[model samples]
Target: MLNHFVRVTGLSQSAQMGALPASYAATSPNAQGGKYYGPDGVGNGALGGYPKLIDPHHNKVVADKSQWAKLWEISEKMTGVKFDI
Candidate 1:
């Protein structure tokens, strides 16, 4: 699992592969604005080991923090939730 995490961290930080556009995301400045997004996967796509991990079609595992961070960045594109990490 440690190795997988390491791989994920690498993929998440890559500029072309995992780094996602987070500036354009709609943010919730509202402290009491209520929850706008859910806590589940929203089916967003991009370069990541997520599909590789969850998708049966993918036959490899990459558990990395940076990699997951990048995946979260892309998810922000769709959900408009910027990860504090």
Candidate 2:
């Protein structure tokens, strides 16, 4: 898994986008906000990743840090891994 991550990190932005579903590719901002790929994935953005920063219940980004923490804790338990801050 780590090797795959490393390999993907080395890919150019267009190459990386080629592997994504249309919806995911579309969600990745261009000049509008911030692109979520390349060396600095999700640079200057809070809501980009494989699982993405979403609230399933609301079907949107979690609006508050406390709520995000709650979701993060649940995900940590499920995955048995804590994300790096």
Candidate 3:
């Protein structure tokens, strides 16, 4: 499963917050932490780590309530063949 993480940068005076440019890691995201912990491959907190997961994908869908148009207008000023999603 693809995990999402944002790169954070800043300093704070808190145990929760370590040194500046803290490696606030957010990995091997277990959406259902504790409630459900998957399998691990080897050593604790190791890279190439596990908890094997099968990414679930939803059907490609377009919402109806959205105001944005289906096709993306690449650029109003640019002249080129624009691709649509």
- Best TM-score goes to which candidate? 2
- The TM-scores of all predictions, comma-separated, are 0.25, 0.32, 0.15
Clashes of 2: 0
Query: How well is each residue in 22-49 modelled by candidate 2, as lDDT tens digits?
Result: 3453565532233323222364222223
Clashes of each: 9, 0, 0
Query: Counting only residues 3 or more apart in sequence or on different chains, how many pairs clash (N, Cα, C under 3 Å) in candidate 1?
Result: 9
What candidate 1 gets wrong by more than 4 Å, as runs, is: 1-61
Which should have the higher lDDT, number 1 or number 3?
Answer: 1
User: Candidate 3 regions off by >4 Å?
Assistant: 1-39, 52-85
Writing each residue's lDDT as its tens digit, candidate 1 over 28-51 gives 342223222221123334323221
Best by lDDT: 2
Candidate 1 displacement at residue 18 in angstroms: 27
| lDDT agreement with native, every candidate | 0.40, 0.48, 0.31
lDDT of 3 by residue, 1-85 (tens): 1222212321112333322112212344434433323223243212222344322222234333242343445352256665555
